[model samples]
Target: MPHVIVKMYPGSSEEQKEKIAQEITNVIIKHTGKPEEAISIAIAEVTEDLWIQEVYDKEISPNKESLYKKPGY
Candidate 1:
């Protein structure tokens, strides 16, 4: 089972989130051959004020070796 967590600045609509999840699920299914039911997606809303400490420093910077696409900012 592959679970995806998308963390970003909060502002996206519910429909946008749903579309994002669906698109990700489709890509996962297409590439990994995993069934849609086996995949789970979560979107965490992080404010700009706390982004550096809450996400970038904790997750991205520390885990750069494992990242497929690195953030520019």
Candidate 2:
């Protein structure tokens, strides 16, 4: 069971989010051999003002070893 959470600046439309989720699901299925029904994706809209404290600092910075692609910022 794998759950993916994507946190980004808010602006994407529902269709865009759906497409992104589908693509992510496809990749996860391809790599992990997990069925679509076993994967869950969540998109969280984080504002720029709160991104550092809420995301980068708390999540990315602390989990650098786990990150596959680190942010340049």
Candidate 3:
């Protein structure tokens, strides 16, 4: 099972989110040869004020394994 998580600021419309998820599912299907029905996508809208503490510190600073590519690393 491939679960995709999109973390960003909250502002996009529901239609936009739907489009994003559909696009992501297409990519996953092409790359991983997984069926669309087998893939899952979740969007995590994080407030800019807490991005550093919630994502950077916990996910990035903790050895940088969770992050594939970032600006300064």
Clashing pairs in 2: none
Give all candidate RMSDs, comma-separated.
Answer: 0.6, 0.7, 1.7
Tell me the TM-score of each prediction against the true structure.
0.96, 0.96, 0.86
lDDT of 2 by residue, 1-73 (tens): 7999999899999999999999999999999999999999999999999999999989999999999999998
**Candidate 1: TM-score?**
0.96
Q: Write the per-residue lDDT of candidate 3 for residues 12-49, one digit (tens) a residue.
A: 99999999999999999999998889999999999999
Per-residue lDDT tens digits for candidate 1, residues 1-73, read 8999999788999999999999999999999999989999999999999999999999999999999999998
TM-score for predicted model 2 compared with the true structure: 0.96
Error of 2 at 9 (Å): 0.6
Lowest-lDDT window of 10 residues in candidate 2?
A: 1-10
Could you tell me how far off, in angstroms, the CA of residue 52 lies in candidate 1 after the best superposition? 0.5
Clashes of 1: 0
- Predict model 3's lDDT versus the native: 0.88
2 or 3, greater by lDDT: 2
